[model samples]
Target: MNTYDPAALECLAAIVEEGGFERAAQRLNVTQSAVSQRLRALEAQVGSVLIVRSRPLRPTHAGQLLLKHTKQMRLLRADLERDLQDLAPRSPGGARDEERISIAINADSIATWALDALTPLARRNLPIEIITDDQDFTQEWLRSGQVLGCVTTLKQPLRGCRVLPLGAMEYVAVASPEFAKSQLPDGLSAHNFRDVTFICFNRKDDMQAEFVARRFGLKRVSLASIFVPSSEGQVRAVAAGWGVTVVPELMAAPLIAKGLLVDLAPGFKLQIQLYWHSWNLESEVLNALAEALTHAAGQSLVA
Candidate 1:
């Protein structure tokens, strides 16, 4: 096939990301009719359907393929512009304009040490946005342009993005002092609490149950598990002696120190390897933030 029309593909992708031709026009500072015409020309050039004309429009498979390439092109262009600027004479009021950046990260990091890594960026007053969700699904958002960066568990980079290992977040099995006294076995065996109730962050959370199974030599647990969504609530539930729960080292540290909860085992550990994934662009702001996160992770976790 002939080389794809870069300009037309960009316009089409912008339309998809902005949700409509009118919005895309606003972003590109052009007329809506011009955006529509460009899209039609793109479809003709590609010889396939590229979009679904539905509310909050969706990209067809071909559209998605083109959209991914267009975004990479955008990032490359931005980097080229930066390099060109560096070669030019400094403009008046010399600081670069603030660029908006969004990142997707897991909730535990939000509550614990992620903020510390983010502290320098906050001090610089960078226009940064954070989208918090389960680690397993955060990379899916990065695939679209919803976030330009993310902290993900996946070692591999998503399409059009690069990945850098952040570090491992450790988790420990814990329970309230009172609850442990009543529910745990005298010898703490694998089959000790075949019927003990436990607290779980959500269906996506298998931390506590996994610890139990590993400690007991079972593939899975059939015991009663309670679902609690909030990080604070899960820890509080364990503190209240409601049940046992496995919590991140950062989350369980203070409570364990205060004697609100006790470690189920002193040596058991769970570490999730994290990565900082972002568009492979040359924006100074994005690069600075990446450095800040890496520095923070180094200090906080076993990178």
Candidate 2:
């Protein structure tokens, strides 16, 4: 196996993560010319084109493998930092941008328990970037090696990853009190559900259709939806009477308790079982993240 330069690998990660050669150079405290030279050198050494210089830069397959390799090295070094913190903290002299610990988590989890779970790590100045997507799609970030771990609905382990069940989060169909009373007066029955717009986290989110289908026993279900990319944004939209949404029970609970948001169907609970997938390495950073998420899930999610 040919050994690659660490600086070259950092250049690759910076370019992808920062989204441009200019930004990568700024992050690395290097000139744009230096960034291009390093990337070219790395590609020449590997004898492959690593990047596709498109509108938004993206890595080619060989580049993705190198990026994944870079991420694993970062993880190992992060673990080392954790271990050495008590003895001597590393100098914060150079570009720490590439040191970010990236994880893909469903937005619902981020709006709910994931942030609390990650508080300890964040407080200690761990560079963390959360990539949010639908629960079903978060695993793709891990599959592509863009993130070290992810919280997703996928149970089948990815190659070289370990899986941990984080319990099931119950999703409830909720809307503002006035909207429910005015529009869904019948409470999302088979006859009236079609009349209301369902607010979704994004196009990839199908929780609204899933909840309605399972609740009403329809093999095929479709919903008219407007997208709200953020979980908090979804809540705000529904609260402002934009539309009804299927969200985690915990997210809707406080509002439900406050009589701001009403649970449309009290009898039906849509539980999405969540799993933690991470690189199967004996590293403290990954282990801590897993433990924190698992513990928080046990308390908040249904067993």
Per-residue CA lDDT of model 2 for 148-185, tens digit only, reads: 99999999999999999999999999999899999988
TM-score top scorer: 2
Give the lDDT of residue 149 in candidate 2: 98
Candidate 1: minimum summed lDDT over ten consecutive residues — where? 92-101
Cα distance off (Å), candidate 2, residue 57: 1.9
Clashes per candidate, residues 3 or more apart or on different chains: 0, 0
* Model 2, global lDDT: 0.91
Decoy 2 TM-score against native: 0.95
lDDT of 1 by residue, 1-303 (tens): 767876677678678767898888887778999888888888888888888999979888788777766655554544554556657633534332112355798878887888888877665444456778777778876886656788989999876678889999988878888777877745245766565777887777766767777777788677678888877888888888887777789889888898988888787777888899998876765687789888888888885
Clashing pairs in 1: none
Top lDDT model: 2
